[model samples]
Target chain A: MTPQPTAASSPRPVLYSFYRSSCAWRVRLALNLKNIPFDTRPINLLAEQNKTPEYKAIQPFGAVPAFLEANSQGPALVESVAILEYLDETRPELPLLPKDPASRAKVRALVEAIAMDIQPIGSMRILKYIGKDKEAEWTSHFLKEGFSALEKMLEKTAGKYSFGDSVTMADLLLVPQFYNGIRFNIDMSAYPIMSRINSELETIPAFQASHPTKQPDCPPELR
Target chain B: MTPQPTAASSPRPVLYSFYRSSCAWRVRLALNLKNIPFDTRPINLLAEQNKTPEYKAIQPFGAVPAFLEANSQGPALVESVAILEYLDETRPELPLLPKDPASRAKVRALVEAIAMDIQPIGSMRILKYIGKDKEAEWTSHFLKEGFSALEKMLEKTAGKYSFGDSVTMADLLLVPQFYNGIRFNIDMSAYPIMSRINSELETIPAFQASHPTKQPDCPPELR
Candidate 1:
């Protein structure tokens, strides 16, 4: 499909992202799948770049994966899921959400299961507050609890991708979170459904390119 | 405006909700605002009713505010934000989201700011992990940080309600999160915009009726 036309005067879409941010990777995956070319401005989370006043002005929460539109209107869409929805709306070539309201709702529920339920639960700030000693346990506890339930929901929904054959918004959320599971040494064997889906997604170019190791800011050894 | 009628054979819409849960209260507010009649099945979180296997079947995440649609599709919409979207799409009488895409994106961003950033930060589960002695301090810190950033975003969006004079999805999220701030004794004076918008929302019937104190499951002391 031919991509949508941009106003010449408009700025190219820019993503303010962190290399290791699952939220940032979600946006990266969606952008790659949609075949929309955008520039990535890396905000280093580990070094606390997001905490700076400038970054906070961009995203009030000082979180990464904030998207600037081709026309760049309103507040920079700060939330990852919201940015996915925005891109899916404006760029409509490869629609991330299903057309049917019921299907869309289900996909969005899966989106939230990862985005809201799982991802936020393991926020670096929240994990740090829990203290360094138990960070591994704390992350594992939330991830396992969230993934087990998500695997059950995926049983009803997964065909090839997270929703059907198509790469809907759910898959965009799933891949980065699965990467998180890897970081925390989650028992992926327990979640056969997620494991199968992740394996299938690993072959996809968008999923592969959006991997944390491939990002511009990823450390050399990690890359 | 009259609400849409469901198919005669299909069951009435049901919302598994717990009163004081901010997440559940969000769906309650949306249902009320949309003027849809849904039977509330109270799953008391404090008593661990949500942890039961039966409730888990309905909501794989074991969270309250799972919505069973009139037609009941593949999966029950388990997240409050997604449930709000479902109700708005299914019953169009009261549009919880704006028609324009940009505005809708902004509204959803506000939704996530509350749903993802603020509400989940204070999950009773997470707070319990943080320990009881510092619970108030922990909740207060996250709430203040989240609300302060959100207040800035509200400046760009708020008119009479969260988005404009008419109530949208953002208000549903705001009212519940604001109630949570009260529980945590968050210093509200810093967020004049949120306080003002919240004050306006308090006068709305939907917002008032969905209060945590009004639900059947709420204990007498809370009511």
Candidate 2:
């Protein structure tokens, strides 16, 4: 059965997450920023736990960061940005999206730049497809290409945070991507605008607490 | 300067588009579906025209489907889905997003399935990165995998179009991706729900009018 279109509501939301999954991290950051308390159902991608049938029930795509609310019984939502948008629309308090339509569009454009263009290259499936020895090379090439482009966009939209300082959803996607860049050893300093925003974001407790190393499944050594 | 986040406003919006770019096609479909009149500034991706400095002034990332409204002067919105969302918010007459939060999330989920996971694989840059000899193998591998997973999601949400009877944004995204699948020779019949939806959508004037083959820049042979 397809997961029902249940937005965030009642009880607590459950996030089926993996520690290092950047997509999952985006949702975690959104949840934290909204100050919405949530339970984390750790799915260890390194262990391939996401591929199992039980996990598949929640996310047919078998990806990390599937979310369920209201019933929590079934019908979880897949895709990070979808879950992010749901929380913003339902919660209303933290207001991850800006009020004006134009600002909102700019925020979303930044969100997609990372979510669609950058994050996919470093995705587990894509990285695996890229294969062992050359994975980093493949990721670096694409990440840098995307980052360079995003830096240009950020230069226009950024003001303390992506799309101004209020900490919109764009920042949620950006921080995790920056974190991944650190992991891949991409020269973070090269993109001054993104680096500045990421640095500013790191200081926030929500961003810090929601980090990959802080997740339930994050191994202690990495933590 | 960053493109102003001015939502779609006064003056007929101008869409910087290319005939065959699936990303651009998504915006064209949104405009058509909303019955919003628009002007198309053709950016020929095949001719490498998107690389020109004139285009870069509007879209620093230098992609097609950059959008400008209000003054028709500056600060265009880049990213197809962002442009789609902008129009939905501004032109509420057609109502591209569903009402309830959950349904909206579901629609966005299907959108991301194609936008993030599927569409990027068939993108010009990715295919070019894969190089000529292996581009087909690479694209077909990811598209089929994504379609297989998306088909599972559709079984639950689809009614007439994706996310029930309404022609939501998901249909806008799905139509173009399905078209690209045809280009790659991916088997459409394997995903019955998607195939049915695509067939139904083709019967709609908006979808038909927005076809890549019908765009101004489309060559006669392709048309």
Candidate 3:
């Protein structure tokens, strides 16, 4: 039998995402952490599904992780940071941000460092566009530069996770980008704090479930 | 005589920012809009002041727009989005984000499109590293591509500003990136909606005061 909808108040929000997209992984982790039920409609990046006109209608930029909530909404929301904030504001239960404004800002700074500073430089399209010869070198250099700074930032702030013991937006952002770092063979020796935090975060069920390997569209061989 | 601290409850936040830096401008707009008193500590990017050990202590990333809040704080906050959110959360006087979750999401999405997708790619460091020969071409292509998507986004959501009559995070982000587009000579004709919104934003006093030309650190020729 088909299962009933998870949340009774409204239909599950539809998430148009890619299995291995770091940005999409951020939203997936947020959804799982908040216990907010959602349906995933995977847009395969390798297949160029994200570049289609149909996907463009959902996300103007044709990027992964566009979210459409049930009942009423004009169009699917684009940008993973925006989606995470939407869930935090609307759900307000699990609270991806801290109660204190200062602490919340700290969390956001860490998020942007990874999402904006690091991820965009290492994006698949950018790597492809930059040409194949320099892809490994470029990704390695950018990730290392970004991580060196992040390591120092975490040294001052990290506890069990990026912010503290509980997961916030920072942890969600860190995991996916760290996964990318690993994919590029970025040496983790320089980032002990980040390594420790990431190691601890891997044990969390929400993070585990959100791993790219566990996603429906991730390659079977890779899984 | 040197003036006493503006906010009695807490010390006035010291903003470590550069005049032409778009990321720094984002925080400047937020600080001005919120009417939260602040002192600007200019870090000259051209002079490589941001790369100094002194500045690195303030911002581990050695990036401009690190915010140091009053009294007790572990370290100054880096990243403009984080500083903006911190102001909105702590001050909460004039909210940068809307009350509704979806609307807030829309604002954040616009902000990310410029700050993440566009700005990082167009940053001086990245452009210089990309090599001077193709700098203008690469910047133009990236900005135009981003604006094309942003135009569509604004078409659906814009009113007087990016998210209806009042200013939001979208406006703060739009103004600086739009300025950069103009600098690169990216044709704005295709983005009528964005042009209209940006035109309106320029009239606001806070936005005017936060203009790159008005900053103390801006060189006379550039001004």
Alpha carbon lDDT at B53, candidate 3: 73
- Candidate 1 vs candidate 3: the TM-score winner is 3
Clashing residue pairs, backbone N/CA/C < 3 A, model 2? A102-B5, A102-B7, A156-B2, B3-B75
Give me the candidate number with maximum DockQ. Answer: 2
Decoy 3 TM-score against native: 0.93
Model 2 local distance difference test score: 0.86
List, residue by residue over A62-175, the lDDT tens digit for candidate 2: 898888885565578788898989998888998999998888999999999888888887888888888989987898899899999899888888898998778999998898
Clashing pairs in 3: none
Q: Measured by TM-score, how close is model 2 to the native structure? A: 0.95
Candidate closest to the true structure, highest TM-score: 2
The worst-scoring run of ten residues by lDDT in candidate 3 chain B lies at B1-10
DockQ agreement of candidate 1 with the native complex: 0.49
lDDT per residue for candidate 3 within A1-223, as digits (tens), equals: 1121232233778777888899999999999998878888888888889887767766767788888787544477789999999888888998998898878888898999898888999887688778889988888878898999888778767888898888899999999988888989988867888899999999999889989889887889999
Q: Candidate 1 DockQ category?
A: medium
lDDT of 2 by residue, B1-223 (tens): 6544433454778888998888999999988888878888888888889887767666666778898875655578889898889999988988888899888998999999999988887789888888999988998899999999888889888999888998999998898899889899988999999999999999999999999888888999989
Deviation of model 3 at A66, angstroms: 0.7
Q: Cα miss at B127, model 1 (Å)?
A: 2.1
